[model samples]
Target: MIYLDHNATTPVDPRVVEVMLPLFTDQFANPASKHGPGREVTRIVERARREVATLAGARARDVVFTSGATEAANLAIGGALAAAGPDRPRVLVGATEHPAVLGAADAAAAAAAGPGTRAERIAVHPDGTIDVDDLRRLLGPDVALVAVMAANNETGAVNDLRPLVEPVHSAGALLFSDVTQALGRIPVSLERTGVDVAVASAHKLYGPKGVGALVASGDAWARIAPRAHGGGQERGRRAGTLNTAGIAGFGAAARIAAASMTDDGRRQRTLVAQLTELLVGQLGRGAVELNGPVRARLPNTVNLRFVGAGADDVQACLPQVAVSAGSACSGGGDVPSHVLLAMGRTAAEARESLRFSLGRATTPEEIRTAADQVARAVQRVRSLTQSTPIQDEVRDDNRARTARPAGTPA
Candidate 1:
């Protein structure tokens, strides 16, 4: 199968696996313990922490490991709300935020404001980027946090956090970003962007799943309350036993991403352009409409709407090519994508869109094959829609003949 759904998850790199294997075997001791074995394991964990921090341009102590980005997002949103006194009970989240952030903001706000507060949504532009002006109007002293993702998962539209930071800061609100999609594919420095808190997952960067980090600046850490209370791990910020193997793999993945991002991005950008142009060329420009900004988007992602064809039907026709009709987490639901709708697309237009996300392992050969298959699938689905009435007429005529009285049709 040709895999083009890197935004959902990526295959674990073999080098990452090699780094994690040792931890599962010889380095199995708990880092919390103080014995010789434990001390050795603790060093490994700390090193991984530093590597993850380096990937985000944060200090090692500021990085809190969690099960995944979902958990990290929850911790950031909920913790910030709880720490913000009753006076500051509101949260403003991006319209196209992942469910993790949007849901967490609602639940956190409700818990903080006693059913009086609901999370407000910031608007997006027609190109799928967040509207800074909308976000500015929503920011106020009562707002405790403003959650915007560094990059959109479906469209891969990267937001320049510099413009958002000052506005959120001036309002005395913290800026939190979900960098899960941006961490490996682009250059993201949390410190440079002045983002107070950020969350990322390992699996998005070719590392093992079930591992992620919540990186908070020192001031941001002071405002976050611990959600899980147990053995006082993560410097009392988060409480849980560490996933040593997964953390090791995360560190290896971060290191690799840092070293290869420039070259990888350039190559992937070329391939993505090639694939997109091939499809549009084959299907006719009018038949294929690009969903997000032509530039200022992730090099590896392309969301396109196939005119007159439902995304689900097209996907069903091309079983060999793996792509997403929408966010993987939002799949299996019949509704059109919220991201597209927020960007001014009609429900019908949203339903006709598909997202293709390339990755480090994607090859030019695979891209060619996927383009051919996807183009054929879109054409076939459109053809079926156009021919359905004639097909139904033929079936009805056959039935009428079969039901006619014997020898009646002279």
Candidate 2:
């Protein structure tokens, strides 16, 4: 398959896999053990941690390994909220956060127990950028934490977080960014941004799944609380035997992504521009409306609305190419994308949109083929069901049906 869904998850880099293979068996000892074997395992894990820290502009000691971005987000939001002390902690979430942040914020607010300050979502524009005024108005002394994603997983929309950190700090609120989409692909530095806590997953950067990290600024260990309190691993923040092999792979991926940031970004941007031009230029601008800022977006992402098309129908038509109509987390929900709705898309427009993300392995030939296939599929699907009935018609994967062009009904 010609995969175009890097925003969802990426294949593990061969180099990363090679680095991790030996660790799984050769140095399989538990990191907590004091013997030579354990020492070796612990040492390797620390090296991986250092690499991850370096990617985020943090010290090795500040990196706390978790299962993935979801857990890391929970830890960052929950731990920071817990650290906020005495106050009925307030948490702020971006209108376009991944479920990791949205779900974590919900749990954190629920944990507030009393008539405590609750979490609020920052509004966003239809292009997927956050509402700066809404963000400014939301900040206050009672607000304990402000959480915004560095880049949207679905739309490739990049959030300008430098300003976010300052106002958040001015209000005595700590900023926690879900940098899963931004790290490695974009030049993100914890030092320059001044965020208190940031989360990232190795899987998003071509590392093994089930390994991620949370990096915090300053010495806030006293305030940070463990989500899973058990073994003393991760400096008591997370409990369990560390996944040494996965950690090694994460480090390998981080180093590769960090070292090649500029080049990789340029490559992806070129691919995106080419892909988008085909969508609008040849297909007619009315045929496709690309989502998010044309310039300020992740070069790998290209979300488009095939006006009058059911996203699922279009996704199914391109079996050889892997792309997503919505987030993998949404699992083909019939409801319109909340992110799109926040961005100003009517529910109708949101349902008609789909995402195409490029990555390390994507090629020019595959992109051309994928775009052509999508155009043909959209024409075919529109032939069968018109506009409103299309959703019901494409419920099955193999019922031979025809579609006609509706001239990009907006």
Candidate 3:
């Protein structure tokens, strides 16, 4: 199987696996305890924390481990808003934000402002980057926080945070960047960017799942209340026993990603360019619009909109070739992509996008195989799908067509 959905999640690196295997049994101790075994786990967890912090160019004390990026995002958004105090605080988020950030902002606003405090969805440009001017207009006395992703997960567009951050700070509104996509894959430093809070996940960087970190430099955690109140872990911001194994794995993964980011990026771009060339050559012009600007996207991600084929049909047809429509959180639910909708794509166009996210293990040959499969599957789905809803995608039926190549699998 040619797996291409690295954006959704990635296989644990063999090294990460090696690091985690002993923790499951040998390092069996609650990190919260003070015993020798517990202290040993705590020491390892701190090393992981420092490594994660280093990747973000953040101080080690600023990092707090969580179950995953989702939890970190929630704590950042909800916690920041709750700490904002009274006044029916305003919460703003980018249109293309992941559900975790959006939902966190929603919950906080709902609690603070009753039902009507819906977050203002700042409009992102067609290329999937945010407009700082729009954000300036949206910022106000009531606005408590602004949430924007560092690099969009679906479109891979890197948000130019420098401009956005200045406006947000000038407005006295704190900004939280869900840098899960940017942290290890791109050059991100909290010191350089000056974002108030940033969230990152382990699995996204080839670490074990169930672990992520939130980095905050100042008293950013003061206003945010805990979603759960129990143990005094995470500097009393988050309450729970830490996932020692997951944190250890996360730190290890981040270190690897930091060291190899440049190399990985070059390889991914080469493969992406090769595959996109094949797609454009095989599929006619206007048959595809690369979802995000090729130049601005994350090197590892490629979101291709098959103009005349069902995303589900394309995905279903490529059984051994694994990819995703949008976020993996949409388990079994075939909803139109919110990211594409934000990009001004029609429902059909949104339904047509397929994400191919490369990873450390991806190769030139793998990309060619995936590209060939994609071309064939798109063509097959367009020809065979009997549904009238999809027929509208046909640009010109009168155009000459060729039969599927003999080598394509049944």
Candidate 4:
């Protein structure tokens, strides 16, 4: 199978696995222990911390390790709201945010103590990028946090977060970003971008699953309360025994990404363009419409709308190509993509959209094969749906019904 779903998760790099192997067997001591082995393990963890921090443009002390981006998002949103107290009970999140961020904001708003406390969605442009004007209009002193992701998972829309920093800070609210999709695929410096709190997962960057970090500034960290409490790990921002092996692997992955990201992005962007051009050449430009922004998009990602073909039906027709109808978190469900809908697409149009995210290992040959397969699958689905006599009959009946006067007999 040709895997094109790197936005969902990436295969763990062998080098990262190589670094993690010894931690599970020979160096299996708790970092919290006072013994020599434990102290040595602690050093290893600290080194990994520094590596991840460097990639994120954050201080090592500011990184809080978590189980994954979901947990980290919850911790950051919940902690930010908690620290702000009841006075600042409102949360403003981007309309196209990940489920984790939306859910965390919803939960916080639901649990809030005041009457007017709630979570509101900031609007997005038709290209799926956050509307800075809409965000500025929504900002207020009552808003405790603003969550605008660095890049959208489904549409690969990259937001210019620097445009939002001043407005958000002026309103006395913290700016949090879910950078899970952008961290390794693009250059992201939270400190330079003025993002107060950001969440990222290792699995998105060729590291092991179940390891992510909440990178925050010193001020942002002070505003966040610990969600888990027991061992006072992660400098009291998070509490639990560290996943030593996974942490080591995460560090190695970061180091590798920092070194090779430029080359990887350049290569993947070319391949993605090749894939798009091939599909459009075969399917025709009208039949295949690009869903995300033509510019300011992720180098390895593209979302396309196969006109007149349901995404699910097309996927069913192409069993070998591993593409996604939407975010993996919401995949396998009948619901249309919220991200696409937020970008001014109708429910049917959203249902017709599919996301193609490439990875470091994707090749030109694979791209060609996948594009040919996708073109065939889309054609098959469209023909099956548009040529059926039953569908024609249904369309005729619908047109007749509409033409008839209201309340008239059938």
Span of ten consecutive residues with least summed lDDT in model 3: 393-402
Task: Tell me the tens digit of each residue's lDDT in model 2 across 71-119.
Answer: 9888877887777755737888998999878998889878866466578
Each candidate's lDDT (Cα)?
Answer: 0.90, 0.84, 0.84, 0.91
For candidate 4, write residues 125-212 as lDDT tens digits: 9999999999989998899999999999998999999999999999999999999999877888988999999999999999999999
Candidate 3 residue-wise lDDT, 1-410, digit = tens? 99888988889999888888778899979988989999999899899988999999999998989999898888877777777666537889999999888887877777677544557899888888897778888888777789989998888999888787777887778878999988778899887878888898999999988999888876666655666679889778778988888888998998899899999999888888888889889998689888987688899988899887889877766756899899886445768988889888989899988988888899888888888889998998888758544433332321212244657553
Q: Please name the candidate that would achieve the greatest lDDT relative to the true structure.
A: 4
Give per-residue CA lDDT, model 1, range 1-410, as digits (tens): 89999999999999999999989889999999999999998999899999999988888989999999999989999998888877788899999998788888888887776544668999999988899999988888888899999999999998988999889999999999999999988998998889999999999999999999999999999999999999999999989999999999999999999999998899999999999999999999999999989899998999999999888877777757899988887747789999999999999999999999999988999999999999988887777746465334435655787789999963
Query: Residue 74 of model 1: what lDDT?
Result: 90
**Model 1, runs deviating above 4 Å:** 386-410
Clashing pairs in 4: none
Residue 113 miss distance in model 1 (angstroms): 3.9
Error of 3 at 206 (Å): 0.5
Clashing pairs in model 1, backbone N/Cα/C closer than 3 A = none
List the pairs of residues colliding in candidate 2: 125-343, 126-343, 380-403, 382-404, 383-403, 383-404, 384-402, 384-403
Residue 340, candidate 4: alpha-carbon lDDT: 93
Q: Which stretches of candidate 3 lie over 4 Å from their true place?
A: 114-116, 385-410
C-alpha RMSD for every candidate: 6.4, 4.5, 4.8, 8.6
Candidate 2 similarity to native, TM-score:
0.93
